[model samples]
Target: MLRIRGTIGDLPVDLTLELDDGDWARLGSQLQPAPMADAPAAAVAPVKQRDDLWQSAQDLLRNAGQLSGLELLDQLEGLAGDASAAKRLLVRLRHSPKVNVASGGDTPLYSWISD
Candidate 1:
């Protein structure tokens, strides 16, 4: 038995398959990859595990058709200029980030002050 659920293009969907060899032959290219013994180890981490969260968040926001990046900043600017809330959000984002210095605040935010 195989269970799959997610979006296809702009449409959301779900599917389940219970198959024997003959049934699988019908699926051909559509059949998903076989599960391996290491599948448990491949389980994703939570929000604090930045990589997983970043991709997951992007996907969720994209699915919801929300504005990203520059727009996200513009929305936050409503709260304050150089806002403590924005800085705190960025700090937490950077601390558990997918890459080093994911946001401008990591260095450039402090550049003028230091120089």
Candidate 2:
């Protein structure tokens, strides 16, 4: 069993994933580190083009396909600005147990185990 710590929705949780070495290897193959902005590039992120964080984040995240939870959040935070509302929205999205993934499937997405 491999225990990984990640943030899902709104709460912090420790996920104990039972995986054999082969399974772990397969998962490792699917994961990719996010591209980091170089020097002269701001690290915080940028405001998203769309107003709806849910829709925008979903599309970007899905397209980005295989990324660690931290990478996914880096992209999401890039879309959020310094607005108080935006911060609140991020909090809500991070902590929520279930989110609408827009596939007509209201599944539990985004686990925010990182406070």
Tens digits of lDDT, candidate 1, 5-35? 9999999888997899977777885676656
True-structure Cα RMSD, model 2? 21.3
Best by lDDT: 2
Score each candidate by Cα lDDT: 0.46, 0.54
TM-score of each: 0.22, 0.29
Residue 47 alpha-carbon offset, candidate 1, angstroms:
14
- Model 1, CA-based lDDT: 0.46
lDDT of 2 by residue, 3-115 (tens): 88977898898988788999988888789565555433344433433446666655564565434444555666677644554445555555544333222234324432322
